[model samples]
Target: MARAVVRAVSASPTAQAGGQVEEDPAHRTAAGLLASHPWHTTPLGVPGGWDPALRATIELIMGSPVAMSLAYGDAYTLIYNDAFATILGGKHPAAFGRPAADVFEEAWATPGVGDVVDRVYRTGEPFREAETAVALVRSPAGEPEQAVFTRGCSVVRDSQGRTIGVLTVATETTEATSRLQSLGELTGALAGAVTLDDVARVALRYGLSAFDVDHMTFGVDDASGWRVVRRVRGELLDEADERLPPLWRRLPLDSPSPLAKAAGSGTAAFTEDGTPLREVAADRHDQRQRAMAAIPLSTHSLRGALTFGRRHAHLWLPAERAQLTAAADLIGQAAERARRFETQHGTAQLLQRSMLPEHLPNLDRFRVAARYDPGIDGSAAGGDFYDAFVLPEGRLAIVLGDVAGHDMHAAALMGQVRAALRALALANPDPVVVLDGLDKLVGMLGTGTRSHELFVTVAYGLLDQRDGGLTIASAGHPAPLIRHASAEGQLATVGYLDVPTGTPLGLGGAHRAMTTALSPGDTILLFSDGVIERRRRELDDGLAALAKSVAEAVSGDPRNLCALATSAVAGATEDDVAVLAVEYASTPSRSATMNVPPEPTMPGRVRQWMKVQLSAWDVPEAVIGAAVLCTSELTTNALLHAGTAARVHIDLTPERLLVSVQDSGTRGTVTRAHTDTLSSRGRGLGLIEELSDAWGTDPTVRGSTVWFEILLSEDRENP
Candidate 1:
């Protein structure tokens, strides 16, 4: 049975490479490559001797008709059936039994394919890309072409529950796809990837390098209907017209127009005059139009067609017709790849954001806002992460760090580092101690690691909510910038914090902290290297430019300030960028704090204390009642879910009353108090939501902070 699965991949009768027929040596099928090849020299080492799990998986995919590939073992050696060999372009035959990395050399560098494959293998997380543009044959016989593949991946685990490899099932959807993404511009990397219109623009740019046409149109189908996109060559149309997509017209499926007929019938047609083409594109196909050609694409699966028009009457040679088909093929490939690249890149951003803090604490004392912009090559998650949370006392912990990578591993490591920092900060609120512990943990994480680029730079600071005092520490990170303001809230001096620098975490170094007092209305800014570091620009110059930009344009608003800081390098995706701003208020608010254990009586006890405190502070009678009721629900939530000591804090001002309850986690344990832990706890949150003016649960690194606020406005305070 094992050998039966092995024989399924034996050699094909004929093999083709680069539009040339190949001889017997490399003319074997997948099965032949598996059977006759020297497996001992490769990573798989004795292919047919694989475990039952590997063999079973192979047998499962072999009987199927989809284009699928199997990457086995740690090295992810390749194995695919005949269906997949069609899309391999020039990579096949030679790619039959090679490591995925070695086979898809250029492809391995991009996202959606190589990064996703590596991530799936390492973390056992499956990934699916819609239209991953794979450059299979860049210049097949001097005719540059592309193949678009949409593939799904899943982990192949052994019986022992250990992940061994990744199984990929792919479908070539280039012809059927419509939403074409930009595949980098002809000038290379303009506005990121270029659009379907851009591909036509490229083809038309060099006059198709051979085929001459005054105008070109590529017709595609989507949910709306079949649509023909037209492009007039060489500034024949005004700039405004060229910038728009199509004429916003939908061609009916059964229409008699040439474009419609070609798409519907899946056939290619040519007209010597503009009479037939004038029905749909009368504006572009004027009387002077010499000829038009409509060629159906892979209509059997993907419904699309290509139309080209010539300005002068000319003979239509067979090679010229072939070039039109080739151009259409290139466009179809771009459309598929563009869609695939977008979906894959979007998912990577989602994964990166998922690891970040879901909600920043709405602390009344601090005005905070954070901004994160992914790099241009967003196929992988950038390791830059920022976190802001409430510590033991009223101290607000603000941390922003950059891990040394732009992949899943880096993003995962960033999450781990952030989690560890939060835990250490919760146990000990001292800035220096928290970083010292992180430095050690980061060093420990580096031991026995394959990557030599295991460096981490972090900026951690603690701001006392009770006062404006702040202590900041750094580990090979840039110094945080602080913007001061005068009593009148006017613009003031902005400069870097005097933090004592140390080596990036993982490399041995001692850490230190520097203390500074922020006057009321002042703000501190923390950012990743992406903000000040521009491509082909000096570091000192960037710093100087940022300072001047802040002084001239930035106001006291934290949101506005952070926005400008992140956009300093504007549209440049050289690296992952992040900026966090925290502002200190001028006025003080009265506050009271108490700790509640997991005991059943803690809720009632907390309510009584909250009531007495609110009444003593002269809070409105109606507001007092609502505050006490909401406090009880929050306290009950902690008592039921956290199972540890919790802190209840109440802050009162003339404007509104803010109450927060945070669970003090079990030392060294990560506890997430999800809202649906139990039916009663869920109802408890429900009750809080109903009574409080506005309530929210902050997702902390460890445990949770459930907060509610009651505005002191009339009619609202009483409720």
Candidate 2:
């Protein structure tokens, strides 16, 4: 009980004119306690001689329902009501008539409380604290516990406005404030998680710190019910113990365990007896976990649960269970989003791979490598592709192109264009002719379709194995970069090809081919615009950076060079990327030219000249046999069809041997007709095709030159 002292004062006749003030029951209760207290004989003197301001303030505090107190006089005597006495705990009656510091010695000694009280008394100004924490002994024999309070202090004044005491009012908010702060920290930590594993790791780390638990396990629902994905032990575990049993690594959702029940009901559950779950948790760990809790986690596409364990038997409070449930919900939502994205990304990759080539063709004269990467947005497939294949006459055709969209439609169109180009290229050896045919094909395919405006940019090249040069043509595509070796053996980009940029396919236009020579040890690089058309970067800057990277990796392997180039720009652009690098291997050059008369003996003369040249070059007998047969077939076709003399040229290199037979008449196009089984005259081109690795025709100043190449056997030693 708390007490207050009442002073008896004799009133003058004028003062007695006003009716006597009514005594409040709360003030009377305190007065009775203070009258019997020992401190009644102290310097404060039973409150009879107290100042008018102190007496008035005490009366106001006793009458109010608010918890308040008043400290008066030089010694600051204590005076408070029943409401405030509850805060005093067991010290209420003993605290009566004593100085404020003596009654609340422990609390007054706290940093902010005492200072605030003194400042309000001295400055005659109000002081307030939104939240103040103090350690105080609520009972005489009890240990001190920390309590948080929102306190306000103001000066008490008499009728003349002279300060005489300090009045204080306070409210305790320890539990509410602490819970809010802990929940805030947990939410902030979970916001940064972007993957399922990230969510598990972050939740485990913060949940353990925020809750009272010895260990925690996080489980997610999968094909095998619920499985623990992460396990974390609290500080109670011994640091030296490395052997711990795998506890609760897997749990069946339909089981009678607390975690399962919680997940099934979508609610929080707890158990004091760990025996029910001990079998599942029986790992190498020796800690006697006697108590546990389960919090259900669920979202639109995800279902999971979290379990917490304690070494001693304990009951969870309602507040603790609520916080755990909220945290579990956050983790479930984040993980669900991550899993959805992963599935979409995997599907897009599968679709993109199906559209691109599995591997570039293996060439003996050139080292070829190519790479394709999808756009930054991983959900949709982009339209970038690269192809390398053997053409007639030992030429290698490298194609890199991009359709004008970033969806499945674009990928489908890319596949159609690629297949059509390959089929057309086998019949015609000229890049210009190939592009012209491709343009018409694309136009026909796009007409009257939703993708009528969809166009494709392409950079196609035919590599001449005999001279180690490239004949390139562009269809509104970025020019190919040619790297030339300097005298010091260092490589640099000579320049982009100067080919005329024709209109993109799907529209009608004339396409021309430009010739660029590549020496041994030189490389030709072709790429989609995604490599040099990044956001916020100028086209020239990107091209310059690409050139620099290529020059630096000049001595690197062709496969590694392609990887480096694609990686540099893969993430910087939103378009799909395709890069192809072709390096010419150095080979000894040899050539023999012979003129064949326009006679019935032309085929025999051509074969004799090929045999002589091949024998002098020390070629293998297998290759000599194939080369002679292919030469005879080509010579007979040229002299019989063109009605002119044939100019025969045989060029041999370390990789392949080229046979060129030119005629005085011009035949720009040669089609491979399907010959019947009994037709002998039409089998000339068929036999040439069957015997040679590749064959093609190129129009020259005099006439047309048709050629074929036979790939030499690897077992034959190079000269």
Model 1 C-alpha lDDT per residue in residues 240-334, reported as the tens digit of each score: 33432223235667766666778778778888754555555455444446687887755223577766777766666675666456445444544
* TM-score for candidate 1: 0.48
User: How well is each residue in 536-584 modelled by candidate 2, as lDDT tens digits?
Assistant: 7778888887777777652423554565577554235767778888878
Collision count of model 1: 15
User: Which candidate wins on TM-score?
Assistant: 2
Residue pairs that clash (backbone atoms under 3 angstroms), model 2: 3-30, 4-30, 245-283, 245-284, 245-285, 392-694, 392-695, 393-694, 393-695
Off by over 4 Å in 1: 1-266, 270-293, 296-303, 306-323, 363-365, 392-394, 448-452, 486-492, 534-537, 567-573, 585-719
Q: In model 1, how large is the Cα lDDT of residue 686?
A: 56
Candidate 1 CA-lDDT value: 0.66
